[model samples]
Target chain A: MNVPAATRAIVVARIRKLWPVLLVSVAAALFFGWLYQNAIAGRQAGGEVNLGAPDAWLLLPTLFTTAIAVAVAFACTSHANRDPFALVEDAAPLFGRERARANAIIPVTIALAAAAAQYAGARLSPHYATPPTFFLFNAIAAIAAMLVALSIPLRDGAARILYALLACGSTLICTVVALAVIGFTNGVAAAKAGLAYYPNFNDLWGGVAEASFAALIGFIALRQYGEALARYDPLPPANE
Target chain B: MAILEMRRASFARGRTNIVAPISLQLEEGGTLHWRCELAQAGRVLARMAAGIVKCTAGSVFIGDYDPKIQPVQVKRLVGFIPHPPPSNPFDSPQAYFAYRSDLWNLQCASAVERGMRIFLALHAQPPNLALAVSGALLHEPKLLVAENLEAELFDELANLRGAAALFATR
Candidate 1:
């Protein structure tokens, strides 16, 4: 088979294997979104609703998208890394690198699809059209997770687990720092004024955080891919 | 001219030398049995020939292509079947062969025809064994590197000595 044909076959097989997980993640997001909307509607009907902030409308979907994206990214990466055919396939000409690159595309596509669905669902209600910034940040966060997942080496159970934990923790910490800088800039009063003047500033820090995380992931993945190509063995020496 | 050649080639795994420096050459239509007491040595040799493992010292060449520099070309010229034959419980031999053929870029019709011929010739053998041997031949590789072939298959291949090169290790 030619390069394109081989790549297409590999990607199709991966998607087929991951269909169940993707389906469940999207379905769960939609279900929870529906419930959240209903809860808000009930409170508003009883005149007991205290919507804290207008941007809060975007929080539910953002969190849902991030959670789902991270979960799917982790599952896809872990499965690909541990596949029985990994070493054999990697040894094949043009197959290994193509497979690795193709694997990343699946999680990114799924994350984007999930984000779109959430945005569209939120649009159905008044005053709930999420800002474009939210969608952008969510997509970036998901892509960042996928890149981090793909950057990890395979065949080392303990190392894989540790790297995964560290990656997640670092991403979370970076995001919080970005949010704090944006939320506390020039004191809370000036931050509130800035948000009022430019509403996108409300979640601007989220986008910044995700963008930086994606850049870091991209760097790590490049290095890892280079090392993989140069190395003879997939696993490190048993001694170390 | 040798179709597969190794010059003082040695391989090390985590500072432990698996293959001591050895030089060998096999012509286009020759057979070589790499007799070694260690199964790991045989496995490493097959992988080196197939470009799956790199030689730490000296060099390896398949025809004019160096496996280290032109791995794709070298791999195309060699077919390797590791000992015990890699198998998946979920995959039938037919499905496995089909996938292998695609990966190797073999013409589907020709691969199928060759597979059938091998199957008929080895009809008395176990189905999986027959299939595994036939699957490796689907691409009509110039050199076949197998590990621990049974007597029956060895005899069958011996009859075709003039048609292709064969290498086996135990």
Candidate 2:
């Protein structure tokens, strides 16, 4: 569909309007990457678990999630463009436009700062935290912004996908907490230590977090394409 | 049966009266020419824009029912074109004709052939005057209301001595 120039302009305006959300999303990916490269990937795990393995495939999900964050940012920009958030000159600002600009940006910067803080915080306090838990909180927060971006007004597809990932995210975080308690109290016996030594699904948690973030961002970017598909994204029929 | 009745309707923009209270009666297969001066075209075109003449205000019976209430409903059976100039920025006359064909609900495929022929015959380059517009006219309209057309289409009017024989109805 050839989005009229007028519509495209509105999208840019919306992006500027919602710049903070996008900033935080992109910032989260960078922090996630930092955690993967510096925190989890650095530590020595069991030979089988392989957190320190060279060229580990663990970074895949982190990259994926980063792409998704970009997509959501682009979509938010595109949607605003698609419908100019304009009201009658005398009327109040449009729905999403009403958010405080300064406050919004502050949170975005703070969110990124928090993610970096979390990643470094975990790397320093490795005994108290597991690799999965370190990445999991960042994942949860990145997922939160995706949920918020997609849940605005009538569009909920973003929200739905974010919700599903978030559910899976909760399960992963819970497992990490359980492992930490087990490792702390009973002590690291050979078998238990081997389990920790050998890398497991917890590593995948960090990877998946990145993958999810990037996928969301990539989708939004594609949606911004001018003269794209002929139809508005009609959600698939209920049965489909 | 009379298709429309304007009744003494007057439309205004602010204090200016664009079109005064004008009344006219139309029936299927009826063709009438205003034969008024050049400025009258603007007034008549305003009526087309107002949805009063083309659809409502008057008893406008195109095919089955009165179109006064169903403004868009009249579009399938009717097509309108205002004089072109500043409004059309398209590269070629055909470019706009093709776009407007779908936009105005006219046949698109044949528009290319018809547009080429019409522009070639009536409108040449040097002077480039938008002499006349023909849409759904190739098939023949039951009634055609054209304003400010050149002398060439005078006989094309359905009531003209040489033309009424062509449509056999309008």
Candidate 3:
């Protein structure tokens, strides 16, 4: 049905209104990445290069949390603003499932791009080497968490607040679980040693599990969003 | 068979009924002007017939397709001009037509050019009723639903061969 073409059209329309927010999302991610690099560099110059001393271990979690928060914020802003689809909605030969998928494009891209940018920036630190295998999977998990948070019905003020909290909490939980998996597989000794070498198979398996978890959550959340989009009635709000 | 039909369809919010149960039909080359108050209730009714608002009871159909179950097919068959038409986002009429062509994923450049010429010819006043109708007709839909349209324009619109029209009047 030329789903890509339909999705592209919708995204283009949305981008006209939302380019500023998207720019901010990317800038914020880059800034955080630069900040992480500085933090690690500062710790290394002072001779406290260990992960625990500089709280270097907190880097991944913090990065993911901030990226997801930005994504959630973007979602809220888009929702509160004028409906982008209102114009062509009734005339276009696109239904609810396609609409839902089209809607997710901007936010999901924001989350993934932000995560990638920040991780790249942090890699510039002299103390750090290649990124861990699990980090990518955890980043995916963050995307899933963001989707779950966005799936919360934005009918009212209470729902908005709940969505924000859920976004933060879900991403944070996913990041922590991913870290815990790595910690358990390699123990505290590996963490105490600076992150220099590539991650082992144990770490890789843990990452797969974490990424799989994210995929499952994202799938379910997307389906729910599609169903809700189908049932959604915009008349009441417009009439009021 | 009717190109558009509503069988005792109704819409409500909470306990209040926005549109009372109503039945109507329009066939090819025919026209129906529904008279109601313009602001709230009539707008809702027009949207219901266009499949933008689902009926709380009964059903609505466009060329044998139920809007609730086959929204894409119904939308493909129907051309809609809403009460408060959306403003033109593009700088030129050609750009607007291009945007529509891209959106609907149709290679109807010729049709778009024809629609644009019609739009420019008729768009002399404000609120852009001409632009709305011309844009709606770009898809060459079998049924057209226009809300709160000017009565004088109906004769002009009827010139389009074989397309049924439903106009909501104040």
Candidate 4:
């Protein structure tokens, strides 16, 4: 069958939606690399890091918490909004199933779970600040949620794009907000006491606060996911 | 009365049409089949499984579930087939079933080991590979509708008679 030019266009659009996620995940990974270097090498990775860095690295898992949250939000949005395997899905193989509902809550739930795990884990293991384990866990959780949401069906071009935007943007927004709060609080000099750990666990408030938000975010996200699912339509004879 | 019913249902996306004025009905012993020579059959099947597309342009009834009013309920009765259920190469059959079973809400008493062994024995497929074909026929639902087919598949519909069920599939 001559593939419709329109189908090709949709494929391109899906790629575009996925691109930002790729870019951001890379950037976050690189930044975390620096954090690792600082913690291990006992020297700044490159230039100087501000002292009163106003960080929630103590309250949260810091780099990883932020990265995972952003990564997951983007992943779920993209998966729901795009026909990642459009050609195959359209073929209607025997006993094949397409999901009509997108579970936004799952990712958010995972995101919260990730944040909680990171916060609590980091707090418990304050000796090494880089906390690679926390970051790894968050990344895994976000990806898992995305894969699940992608199982659902989506019919609208606009809705797909919007889903991606929501997924990619929401956690980043949370991360930014967290950063802003940290900046406002300004890292207490004592916050740096865990140089062996990079960000110390002396301040346990971050883990608790971020974990709570993770729960709230997951709750709100599930509701939104369900709403999006409600909007799906498989065959569009009417619109045509 | 038909075990499954579809009224003048229509669906649209933006300005394009996806499903058009579709009306149909099925009794207990009916089998219907359709195949779209389009991109990604799995994606197409997924879209059909999701319910917001049906409109009063007519209504659809499945068992006691109404497509218009109880979409989630209809979803359970409706089994969608994706040719290839996604999977990780390293995952065991037990892990794969455990993961997807969470999504599909299959009977928990039905152990992953049992499901894997049954499909493996029936399909003669490898244990680790995730099969894309979603076996909705097994749900023994009061009503069911799905895409795609193999000539021999419905041949065994008789085995499902004990389900005392009603459903149709394409």
Interface RMSD of each: 3.9, 18.3, 2.5, 12.3
**CA lDDT, every model vs. true structure:** 0.61, 0.38, 0.65, 0.42
* Model 1 Cα lDDT, one tens digit per residue, A107-145: 667776776666555555554533556556555655655
* lDDT per residue as tens, model 4, A1-240: 763332333333334444565445545544554444445334334334432344333323333544454455445433322232332222212112122222232343445455445444434433345445435334433443343334233424566455555544444443443333333345543333322232322223433443455456555655554454444344422111
Error of 1 at A49 (Å): 16
Cα lDDT of model 4 by residue, B1-170, tens digit? 56566676554444754445566666655555444443333233334433323453556676556755666666555544333333432245454344344344555347465555445554643322223322333343444343333445544433433443323233
The TM-score of predicted model 3 comes to 0.80
Give the residue spans of candidate 4 off by over 4 A.
A1-49, A53-67, A70-218, A230-240, B34-57, B83-134, B150-170
Give Cα distance to truth, residue A195, candidate 1, Å: 13
Model 1: runs farther than 4 Å from truth?
Answer: A1-3, A16-84, A107-136, A151-216, A219-223, A226-230, A234-240, B88-95, B148-152, B157-162
For candidate 1 chain A, the 10 contiguous residues with the lowest summed lDDT are A231-240
The local lDDT score (0 to 100) that residue A226 gets in candidate 2 is 16
Indicate the fraction of true inter-chain contacts that candidate 1 also forms.
Answer: 0.21
Position A73, candidate 3: lDDT: 48
What's model 1's lDDT at A37?
58
Listed per prediction, chain B TM-scores read: 0.88, 0.57, 0.89, 0.63
Sort every candidate by lDDT, greatest first.
Answer: 3, 1, 4, 2
Compute DockQ for each candidate against the true complex.
Answer: 0.27, 0.02, 0.44, 0.08
3 against 4, candidate with superior lDDT: 3
